[model samples]
Target: MTIRFDGQVALVTGAGAGLGRAYALDLAARGAKVVVNDLGGDPHGQGENRAAAQKVVDEIKAAGGEGVPNFDSVSSYDGGFNMVKTAIDTYGRLDVVICNAGILRDVAFHNMSEEDWDKVFAVHLKGSFTVLRAAWPVFRQQSYGRVMLTTSSSGIWGQFGQANYGAAKTGMLGLMNVLKQEGVKYNTMVNTVAPVAGTRLTASVMPQEMVDKLKPEFVSPAVVYMVSNECSTSGYVIEAGAGNFSRASMVKGPGAQPGMAANLDAEWVQANWDRICSLEGAVPMWRAGQTLAAFQAANAKQA
Candidate 1:
């Protein structure tokens, strides 16, 4: 079946160029009224160029799709509110939000400055909060919404000189985990995308040929699907890029239950370290309470 947005409205932050621009254009092309938002900042989040967002909006219009340009920084609360307002004012409703706005400050942890950490968190982590906090109410009241947050491989795994960026990206998972539960009752589905596309943020690190192959557009299809009405699952972490897609998740090992003993001590933990850390019979944990349940079930089986 064809996935179409039809009368729905979507807001894509950092839509000036790269992934955000690709998302906005794709959503608009599929019949969504898109709000193209870009701070117009450089890769490091400096300076501004309003033309960046307007150009994408122009493309949407040129292709007979509806779109409006927004020049707000996602780091600001007012900027987030205004972006949502733009969609409601122009399209009368908002059905999707793709929090793709991000900035990077790569430096070794020891050499990282407070500003480096703060700026990256402000754009990638807090920026997501600002927009979602603004749009959350609308989603609940309407009882329908699809939210897509951007994560990264650097964040999920380790990366050199990207402590700040990686930490902020990993934080997206926690946010989605909580929002998924809260929004479930309202039919508001939230998911994260860890994309490996070559964008402005990565252009400096990769060769031109590799960048050409890892086009941002290749990652958009999975993202658009996750935020569409057809997607039934929520709180998932999907990795996509270069025509590959996969799910990433948190799993727990079959842990040692030495702590259940009355004389549980550090010595016991030390002796059972290998068992505690073993991945044998590991299971995916969908919620916090599952840990306790898994432990209890293991104990019952042993008894």
Candidate 2:
């Protein structure tokens, strides 16, 4: 079956370039009305230009697809609200949202300043929240919506000199987890992508050979599929780039229990350390309830 968005409206933050641009363009090509939003800031999240957004809109029009340019910063509430307003005012409804706007501030944990941490969080984490919150009501009223939050390998597995960026990216996963539950009844699915695309953000850090292979376009397909009507599963994290796609999750091992007795101490935990950390029988948790249930089951076995 062909996945198309004939009457759908989509908003792609940071659409001026990279993954966001690819997503916006592809959505338009598939018959969706797209809102191309970009503050045109540098990699560190400074400065802005209206032309960046206008260019993408022009490209969409040239390809016989409908699109509008929005020059709103996703870092603030007002900016996020206005971007969604632009979509509703132009297309009359919104069906999808791609929270791809972000900034990078790389620094060692010891040297990272308060400003560095705050700025990264503002763009990646708070920005996603701002836009999603603004669109929550519309999604609820329409009884349908698809949201894609951008995560990163640095956030999931960790990376040196990227403490701030990693923390914000991981926080997005937490937000997605909650939204998935809240939106399930409304047919609003929330998912995440930990993309390894060769964009301005990664140009300096990644090796040239790897960068050549991991184009921004390679990452957009996963984004497109995740937000399409064909996909219904939520609370999923997909890693995509260079024609490679895979799912990632947090899993738990079969941990050792200290029992329900009062005399249990740190020594007991130390003695059973290997069992606590063993990967055997590890499983990905579907929800918070599973963790508690697993603990209880383990205790029952001990009893």
Q: Pick the candidate with the highest TM-score.
A: 1
Candidate 2, pairs of clashing residues: none
TM-score of every model versus the real structure: 0.96, 0.95
lDDT per residue for candidate 2 within 1-303, as digits (tens), equals: 288999999999999998899999999999999999999989998898898899999999999999999998998899999999999999999999999998899989999999999999999999998899899999999999999999999889999999999999999889988899999899999999999888888989888887777888898889999999999889999999888999998888868666686367889778878998999988877678887887788778787
Point out the worst 10-residue segment of candidate 1 by lDDT: 254-263
Off by over 4 Å in 1: 293-303
Over all chains combined, what TM-score does candidate 2 have?
0.95
Clashes (backbone N, CA, C under 3 Å), per candidate, total 0, 0
What are the per-residue Cα lDDT tens digits for candidate 1 across 87-169? 99998999999999988889999999999999999999999999999999999999999999999998788699999999999
Measured on C-alpha atoms, candidate 2 has an lDDT of 0.92
